[model samples]
Target: MELKLPEIPELSRQHRLAAQEQLDRKTKPVGSLGRLEELAVQLCAIQHKVPPDTARKRILVFAADHGITEEKVSAYPREVTAQMLANFAAGGAAINVLARLMGGELFVVDVGVAAEPVVGVKNRKVRWGTRNFAHEPAMTVEETLQALNVGIELAFEAAEDEVDILCLGEMGIGNTTAAAALLCLLTEAREEQVVGRGTGLTDAQLEHKRAIVARAVARHREWVKTPFEALCAVGGLEIAALVGSMIGAAASKIPVIVDGFIVTVAALVAYHLTPKARDALIFAHRSEELGHRYALELLEANPLLDLGMRLGEGSGAALASFLVEAAGRILREMATFAEAGVSEREEQDVT
Candidate 1:
């Protein structure tokens, strides 16, 4: 199947200027709120509204298993992917708690978990699991397109439901190895720069994981020219879904709060496919993963938080939603200097 991507429209510069003017008039000195002001402007530009809608947030967790776990790349067992889906359904996971606290509806999507159908999770499985990229391509081009379409469908559904924002995350064993391999391929970084100790791998295990990434990248480098080709080579099904979701959200004019490392890799692919998609992305936080900084730099993104978070279940995005909401509220609800009769900053005459 030929994959058809949606056309991602650029954010409105007119709305951006309007948002900035409003922020400057908000009684605080210009840019006093710093990144908050920048975020508000971006939100306005994406939505083409003076104040973007920041309510009705949705958190989508894409769960799958990577066959690369066979390489002993991660500390956790592969079955943990299915077990964690059950935990998510039971509201016992950290993301469950965080989503509830942040007033965001959480949905778990089973794209390619190795287990049977998981109860209470969306069954959109493209396959049982991706093939081990250490030996060959992780997914066929057709399977990759299927996984991407599943995410696009979900994101379109969110847009129809009037969801104001989408927060992306993933659950998969040995996915860090896949993400690291993708980072090296996408950003032209070395394995040592992109690989990290996923799930607390020991020093020796981390080195082994790095070696696996190097080998995988070396095996697939020539054919992995496009971002889609790179994804087909070594990306996880959930990661492919993430790339689709970002593109789908952009096409629907919805902003996405991107989570750490793994999701950032997805965003990188999305950006590569549709550079205008970056206009709708709000990076949530920096991860403790070694490659996250490099990925962020490649995307020219400055994340909203950096609390040493490596947990990739949208925890950081959930937390950052509060700040996103606050930024919107500041734009919409704050009294302007003239409205509040506040003295404006004096312009210093230098002539």
Candidate 2:
């Protein structure tokens, strides 16, 4: 049978209803808990517990280089991709800083940067970097499999640690071009709707980048008929590895919080690879990337943030964690109406 997108987490509707019923019994006006009550119920389902708690969060950043840099699609240089890996390892990158603030650990993987693997850094690079897609296929199937295996191995390590929640991020210049190209291939969007200025592009540069991606997609339109094949054509190693991370999270039953465009594109690829991954994921945001909303819509996800953020450091997912926390608190810590000795009226009267 053909693969289908992963199921959303099998939250107990009965249990969620029960939790909400208890929330209704809280000593406050009906629906007074606002978003927290909703969050609590969401948490209840993900944790498979009446209440949820995110005690340990894990953020995985897959760093790599895209061959499309040869097309001048990004403002940052390809060398920056490897340099940022060091920044992440040294806890100086934006994602690392955010993880520190949230007390979450940051793990960086060298999926496919073009440079030799840095010393003292975890070596997960499948290759130095993928070949430029402008002239040839981005990666061979063997390389893709290697990249996926690397991601799975890292995720298995996290699962062994019992990470409660997972966030996916990536570091690669010219990566957004790959994502946009993937969007055009995976969704009903076109070049204009999917392209965005990644890391600051001039208006002229954005147009140039868009045309390059459009040309890339046009060249590969035959493969565009299916999602996974399309990703294989233009997707970066870090992006592909992120896809495997999503798959590993689902297989391990850990909730996966997707970052912005690059990570979400990886998520899209993973869902196609194994549909069940959709069930264990939460949308971290409606990203600023031009194609992010299209990808989220294709997944039928509602992210917790829409700060016009296009920064792809798993930072958006980190911010969204606060909402997940609120949900857990309401489910696990809120006092019910009867417990608080508050008065209650009929449901008809409350509404």
Model 1 misplaced stretches (Cα beyond 4 Å): 347-351
lDDT (tens digit, per residue) of candidate 1 on 160-212: 99999899999998888899998888876999998999899999999899888
Candidate 1's error at 50, in angstroms? 1.2
How does candidate 2 fare on TM-score? 0.91
User: In model 2, how large is the Cα lDDT of residue 304?
Assistant: 81
Give the alpha carbon lDDT tens digit for every residue of 12-35 in model 2. 577678777777777778787777
Pick out the ten consecutive residues of candidate 2 with the lowest summed lDDT: 1-10
The best candidate in terms of TM-score:
1
Question: What global local distance difference test value does model 2 have?
Answer: 0.79
In candidate 1, position 66 carries an lDDT of 97
Clashing pairs in 2: 5-275, 6-275, 6-276, 7-279, 8-279, 9-279, 25-337, 110-125, 113-128, 114-128
Q: What TM-score would every model get versus the actual structure?
A: 0.97, 0.91
